[model samples]
Target: MTRALISVFDKTGIVDLARAIANAGIDIISTGATARVLAEAGIAVSGVESVTGFPECFDGRVKTLHPLVHGGILADRRKPDHVAQMKELGVEPIDIVIVNLYPFEETLASGASPDECIEQIDIGGPAMVRAAAKNHASVAVLTSPSQYGDAIVALERGGFTEEERRVLAARAYAHTAAYDAAVANWMTELADEEPQYVGVGLPRTATLRYGENPHQSAWLSADGKGGVANAVQLGGKEMSYNNYRDTDAALRAAYDHLDPTVAIIKHTNPCGIATADTIEQAHASAHACDPVSAYGGVIAANRKVTRAMAEQVKPIFTEVIVAPDYDEDALELLQTKKNLRILKVTPSEEQRDITQISGGFLVQARDQVDQAGDVFAGWDHVAGPEADEQTRNDLEFAWRTVRSVRSNAVLLVKDGASVGVGMGQVNRVDSCRLSVERANTLGVAVESDVDTAGGAQAGTAASEERARGSVAASDAFFPFADGLEVLIEAGVKAVVQPGGSIRDAEVIEAANAAGVTMYFTGVRHFAH
Candidate 1:
C-alpha cells in the first residue's frame, strides 16, 4: 500500500484529509502528536519510530532524522538499484509528505526568548520535505494545510499527474525558502552589523494595478510587519501606486508633530502641515495653507477622525485620508466620497528608510529627530537682531519642516505653518526666489518690502511684501551671501540653517547688514 507521512504545525483540515486518504487504502504514518490525533480519531496509523525501529532520542529531535525515513522518501521507483536498496533496508516508499514548519515568525513576533525561539525551529521536517521534493518525479510533497483538499481529490480520482507533483514540489521549495529567509532576517536584525549573508524574502503581499504609471507592472512585497500593506481599506476605490507614496509622505509628516496634526501631500512633498487643539481645526488649517495645491492631494492625520473632521473633508477632492482610527459616524460620512480611499494604518514602531538605485538598494535608519523638545537651546544667534520667543518657535517649526524636503530646499513658515516651499533646485538662490514667488502667489501677508528691486519694480515689491515677516529654513548652509540676500530682500524676518559653509562669515555679514535675524543649528539636514 502507498504510504503518506503526515506532520504539521497547523492542524487545520488535517483529520478530514487523513480520513479520505486512509479510506482509499493508503497507510497513514505520523510522529508524536500527529499520530495520537489520528489514533484517537479511530484511524489506524503507524508511528515513524515503529517503522525505523529506533526510539526518539534527544528530546524527540532525532525521531525523523533517521536513515529509514529519508531513504524511503528519497528512493526513485524507476531506478532498479534504488528499489533494491529500499527492499534491502526494509523501507517502504513515502508517496506523500504533509509537513508545515514550526511557527518561528509567530514565536519571534510574540517576544519569545532566544531559547524558546531556538527550540521551535524545525530540523527534520524541512529535511524530509526537501528530500521528498527533490525526488518529486516519484514522490509528492505538500507543505501547506490548504493543499490537503486538492491532494485528497487528486488521490481519490487517481494518482497525481507529473505536472501536479512538480507544482507541489515547487511550492514546497518556496515554503522552505521563505521560512529560512525569515530566520535569517531575524538573526541579522539582532546583530550589531551587517551579517556576511543578507537575505530579504518579501513574499508578494499585493498586486498593484501598475507601477509609477499605468504602462508599467508593479507589486508590493514586505518581509517585516506593519506598513501600507497592513493598512485596512475602510472604504473607497483601490489605492493606486502614487496614492500609497503620497499617503505615506503625508502620514510621516503628520507623525512629526505631537499635537493634533494634519499634513497635505502633493507628489512627494508636504504642501501643508498644521497642528491645532482639535483634529478638525488642524485639518482646516492645513487645507487653508494651500487650497489650490490641496486639490486631489493625500491628507493624513495623527489623531482619530471625528464626524466634524469628516464633514470638513467632505467638500475637498482628496485622493486619500489615513489616520490611526475613525469614529463610526466619521467613517460612514467619509464613505460618501465614493473615490476617496480611507485607510486606518497601524504604523510600524521600527522604521527603516530604503532607497533603490540602478544597481542595488541602500538601507539606513529613519531620521526621526524629536521636534517637540528644545531644539534651539544651544544654537548661535549669529547676525541681525535676536529672535524673540515667538520667532524662535516659528523658526524651529520651519527648521523641522524643511528636514523632509528634498535637497536644495527652502521653506517659508508663518505661525508654525508652511506658507511656501521650493525644493530640488540646483541653485540655492533660485530656490529662495521660487519660495518668495510661491508666497506671493498664496497672498501671504507681509510687512515692509526693501527697495532691492531696481527702479520701482512694482511686481518685485509686491512679491517681497508678501514674503515679509515669514521665517525661512534651509536644509544646508548658504554657501554664498546671495541665497541669504534673496530671502532678506524678500522681507523675511528670521532664518535658520547649518553654519558650516566656507563663506559663513560673509553670509552672517549679509544677514547683519540687512537686519535679518539668523541662527545656526550646527547640524545640517540634507535630504537627497
Candidate 2:
C-alpha cells in the first residue's frame, strides 16, 4: 500500500481530503494536529512518531526531521540499490507528501513578538516537501489544500500520471520558494539589516482587464501592506490598474498640503490642485483650474468627503475619487453615479519608490520633502524685487504644486491655488509657454494691458488680469534667459527655481531686467 505523509499549518479542507485519500486504499501518516484531525474523522491514520518509532522532541519542532521519514520519500524506485537500502533500513516508502509551511507572513504582519514569530517558522515542512518534489517520479507532493481533491482523484485512478506528478512537483517547489522568500523578507525587516538579496512579495490581488491597453495582459499584486489593496471601495465599479496609479499620484499631491486640499490628476500629472477651509471650496477651486483636463481624471482629497463637496463635484465627469472618509449622505449621493469609483483609505505614511530598469529594480526613499510653512525660510532672494509676504506664500504654494508635475514642469499659482500647469515638455521655454497659454485659456491669467515693457509685449486686458500677479514655479533653474522671458511676457510677477545652472547669472539678470521677483530654492524637484 502506498503511504502518504500529511503535515500542514492551514487545515482548510483537510478532513475531507484525508477521508478521500484514506478511502483510496492509501495509508495516511500525519503528525500532531493533522493526525488527530484525521483519526477523529474515523480515518485510520498512522502518526509520524509511530512510523519512526521515536517520539516528537523539542516541543514537536524536531518531528519529521529524522532519516527514516526523509529516506522513505527520497528513495529511487527505479534504482535497485536505493530500494534495497530503504528495505534494509526497514523504511516504508512515503509515496506522497501533503505539507504546507507555517503562516509566517500573517504572523509577522499581526505585530507578533520576535520570539513568537521565530517559533512559527517551519523547517521540517519545507524539507519534506522539497524531498518529495525532487523524487516526484516515485512520490507525489501536494503543497496547497486546493490540490488535495485532485490528488485523491488521481489516486482513485490508480495513482497520478508522470505529467500530473511533474506539475504538482513544480507547484510544490514554487510553494516552498515563496514561503522561504517571505521568511527571508520578514527576518530582514526584523533585524533591520540591509539585505544582500532583496525580494518583494507580490501575491496576486486581481487580474486586470488589460495593461494600459486592451491588447496587453496585466495583473495586480501588492506587498499586502496598504494603498489600493487596503482601500475600501464605498461604491462604484471595480478599480482598474490605471485608476489606482492615477489615484495614488493624486492622493500624494493632496496630502502634501497641510490645509484641506483637492488634487486632480490625469496621466500621472497633476492638472489641478487647491487648498481651502472646506473640501467643497477646495474641490471647486481645483476644478476651476483646468475643468477641461479634470474631465475623466482621478480626484483625491486629504480630508473627509462631505455632502456639499459631493454635490459640488456632481457636474464634473470624474473617473475616481478617494478620501479618508465619506459622510453617509455624501456616500449615498456619490453612489448615484454608479460607475465612479469611490475609495476611502488612510494614506500610507511612508513607502519606498521603486522603478524597474532593464534587469532589476532601482529602489530609493520616497520624495517626501516637507512642505511646511518654513520651506522657504532659507531660500535666497537672488534678483529683482523682493517677494512680499503674500507673494512669498503664493510662491511656496506653487513650488509644492510644481513638485508633483513631470520634469520640464512649470506651474502658476495665485492665492494658494494652482491656476495652470505645464508638464512633460522637451524644453523649459516650451513649459513656460504652455503654462502661460493654459492660464490664458482658463481665464486665470492677468489681463495684459501694457505695451512693450522689459522686452515683453503684454497680452490684452483679460490676460493681464489673470497672469499679472501670479507666481511661477520651475522644477529646475532656467538653462537660458528665453524661458524666463516667456514667464515675464505672460506678466508673471514672481519666479521660484533651484539655482544651480551655469547660466544662473544670466537667468537672474533677465529676472532683474524684467523687474520680476525671483527666489532660488537651492533644491531641485524633478519627477519623471
- Candidate maximizing lDDT: 2
Task: For candidate 2, write residues 61-142 as lDDT tens digits.
Answer: 8999988999999998899999899889988899888998888878877889998889889999999999999999999899
Candidate 2 lDDT (Cα, whole model)? Answer: 0.83
Model 1: CA > 4 A from native:
40-43, 55-60, 193-197, 443-466
Distance (Å) between predicted and true CA of 2, model 1?
2.0
Q: Give the range where candidate 2 is weakest over 10 consecutive residues by summed lDDT.
A: 450-459
Off by over 4 Å in 2: 39-43, 145-161, 189-196, 371-373, 384-389, 443-465
Pairs that clash in candidate 1: none
lDDT tens digits, residues 1-528, model 1?
399999887888889988988988899889888888888889989999888898878887787988888988999999999999998989888998889888888898788998888877889889998999999998889888778889889888977899999999998888888888878866776774755554556666689999999999988775455656678899999988898888878887888778788888999787677676788767765665566677789999999999878877887789999999999999999999899999999776655566778999887767776466888887899998989987888898888778777779998887767777878899899889988887777532222221112211112222335577889999889989999898988889999998999999999999989889999988878777
Taking all chains together, the TM-score of candidate 2 against the true structure is 0.86
Native-to-model Cα distance after best TM-score fit, residue 492 in candidate 1, in Å: 2.2
Error of 2 at 11 (Å): 2.5
